[model samples]
Target: MAAESRSRILIIGVTGNLGFELAKASTAASHPTFGLVRDSAFSDPNKLQKIQNLSNHGVQIIKGSLQEEDGLIEALKQVDVVICAVASAQVLDQKLLISAIKRAGCIKRFFPSEFGGDPDRTRVSNLDHGFYSTKAEIRRLVEAEGIPYTYISCNFFASFLLPSLIQPGLQTLPRDKVNIFGDGNVKGVFVEESEVAAFTISAVDDPRTLNKVLYLRPPGNTLTMNEIVDIWEQKVGKHLVRNYISEEELLQKIHETPYPENMQMVFIYSVFVKGDQTYFDIASSNGVEGTQLYPLIKYTTVSEILGGML
Candidate 1:
């Protein structure tokens, strides 16, 4: 534990959900944690409050921007590991970070901003989704630079999907009706955000996970959309009218949706409907299962999430 604590950890985009959770977990584990915040974050009340909260929790703030190479290099000099939790759209900005890491020459481990589906298997020629493509590019850059790194392919975030599904949102799953894409039998692993953070922090110093893709599929967390809805119905003691959207309709949406968010959703829906999220099996000998590695870590399953929905 003392040796682990000696690892000075730094997280980019700490204002974001994953980054904040990772910072909190790192601090709780007695690791010397540092968070990078943009100078503009100090002006925004919400971001400022979050920064204060992180500070109160013992995270030192390194004020800078990804665009500024000099500032980034200076910041990198203070930490041994760099965990990037930046948004999908801002993933390309990691080029600047990669450059700084090479220049600083001190970071022992680099965890790129890949917290979603595996990009290697999800590529569609016409789709050109920057979310996945940009992440792939970053991976190439990290490898090209010969940086010691770990890429975490944490599948879908269960907490993120729960609210988006239950509440009145883009992909609405109302109390009385739920939308099912394709055959709805495709299984995908959905991990909670905090669990992803916990497992990630735990793996930072573990030599076994170095330069590997750490998968976050817990034992019971894998389930299809239909299976998830079924669990919800069993928990609520009420059935939801299932509405199936055919593959043709989803493909049309992907082509016609003008809004970037909606287009992204269509791409995501295609992934889930096609079962691309489960392309890699975490139980395989080559895979690093989070819960198995850290026996005491409790992963939140879809059943538990559905039961908590009110």
Candidate 2:
């Protein structure tokens, strides 16, 4: 496809982790890329740096927020593809953006903020901190509005969860102990955020991915918690004590904890204990494996990620 003929992508939440990467990939793919960012994002030093990065990469900046429907509709009018990479807190907020997309009626494809497990398959209720339910709601709205959409079900983020050895809050690799959910053998698919972004951007212009879910399940990246710990152990040259959080115990934690913490526990149980990411057959569903779709893309594996951490 000619550069100018490529889909013009407008990524909401460009300052965010995945959103910025999507911007990078979109531009790299010769797509006329745009970013829908709030004016306030320029004030935060961290966000400003990202915004500056986007600007340097030739991403046309659209000064608009989802809250401002008028400005959002105007931004939507300028782009053919709208990808929302907003944080979990703002998943429901996409309803407004959806309304605006309907009003603008120019977007060829809409990628909602669902760069995680497929809510329809994962099956979580109230204890989930409203993460899956809210995303599922947005999907319904997208379909109801008859908006062309692609759902990126790129399960667990390796950078976020693997660094701490799957320990929820810890930011670094554990030295003495790590919590192993269940038998430490329930597998999950973990793709680094940037790779997820790249695969997502690749699907923007794909007809097969239109109104279908793109599952980022690289066979090499599919791993269990025990396998991850084994990799860390080999890197550190020492074995860490395994603190097993059984399914029963995990459910107890989810029920006992409060708000966000409770929500975290719910995810731990869902991903690790229940094995939601790998338990389903993507081929049977309305989805295609990202690696299968784009085998040429060099996806980072868990070992490569852990090796770099050291």
Candidate 3:
């Protein structure tokens, strides 16, 4: 495919971890990619580095804010697809972005910032933060406005959890004790960040994915927490202490922990305990399994990703 013929993609939150991967994948796929950056990114050292890296990759940077209607509309005019990769804290804030998309009236597809669990299925609304509710609201707005969109439900990030062996707040792979949420048998789909970006970019122009949730539950990547622990044990040639956090204990943690951390606990409960990701069937009316959509795209399994870390 020629660069000029490909869709012009504009990513709203390009400085984030997943956002950067999306930008790289878009450019790699020869799409004329654009990044909507804020004025403050130029001042922040880390973000400035990422901006420089993105510019080097041929992503045309359009300096604008989601809050600024005129600037956002101008940016929207230049792209066919708009993908928002903002953090969970900024999910609801995308309401403003959706309104801007409507006003611009040119965006062919809008990928809202929902790269985790499916918000509609996950019942975490009563928690301190409105993570699920906010995402659900954004989905409603996108549908109500009749914006052609794709919701990427990539579930757990392999890079985030696999690094620490699913142990919260630990950077290194645990050598001794590990917290096994529930019986550790509940399954979840874990995808590498780059793989998520690759599959997401592949579906950008795919008609099958339009207005449907792209569930990234690759067969090799789906596994129980206990199965993940067994993989690590095989790699280390030793068994670690498995401290089980019972369902009741996890509920207490959700109630006791503070914001953000508590939010993480809520997600843990939803995926690990409630079996939300694997429990539902993807009806043809709502979703298309990503691996099945593009069988040629090889995804790195959990074991392979963990082995690379060591």
TM agreement with the true structure for every prediction? 0.92, 0.96, 0.96
Candidate 2 residues lying further than 4 Å off, grouped into runs, are none
Instruction: Give per-residue CA lDDT, model 1, range 1-310, as digits (tens).
Output: 6855568999998898899899999998889999999989999998898899999999999899899999999999999999999998899999999999999999999999999777776745356556678898999999999999988888878766665452214453467878777888877787889889999999999998998878777768877778778887887788989888787887777777665646555545646666776765554624576777887888877888766765
lDDT of 2 by residue, 1-310 (tens): 8897899999999999899999999999999999988989989999999999889989999898889999998888888999999999999989899999999989999999999999998756756767788898999989999999999999988866777777877888898898899998888888988899889988998998999999998887888889989988998899999888788888877777777766656777888888888888898889999999998899999988899999
Instruction: Give the residue spans of candidate 3 off by over 4 A.
Output: none
**Better by TM-score, candidate 3 or 1:** 3
* Superposition-based RMSD of candidate 2 using all C-alpha atoms, in angstroms: 1.4
lDDT (CA) per prediction:
0.82, 0.88, 0.89
Cα-based lDDT at residue 305, candidate 2: 89
- The C-alpha stretches of model 1 lying farther than 4 A from their native spots are 3-5, 164-173, 282-287
lDDT, candidate 1, at 12:
93
Residue 129 alpha-carbon offset, candidate 2, angstroms? 2.3
Error of model 3, residue 76, in angstroms: 0.7
TM-score of candidate 2 to 2 decimals: 0.96
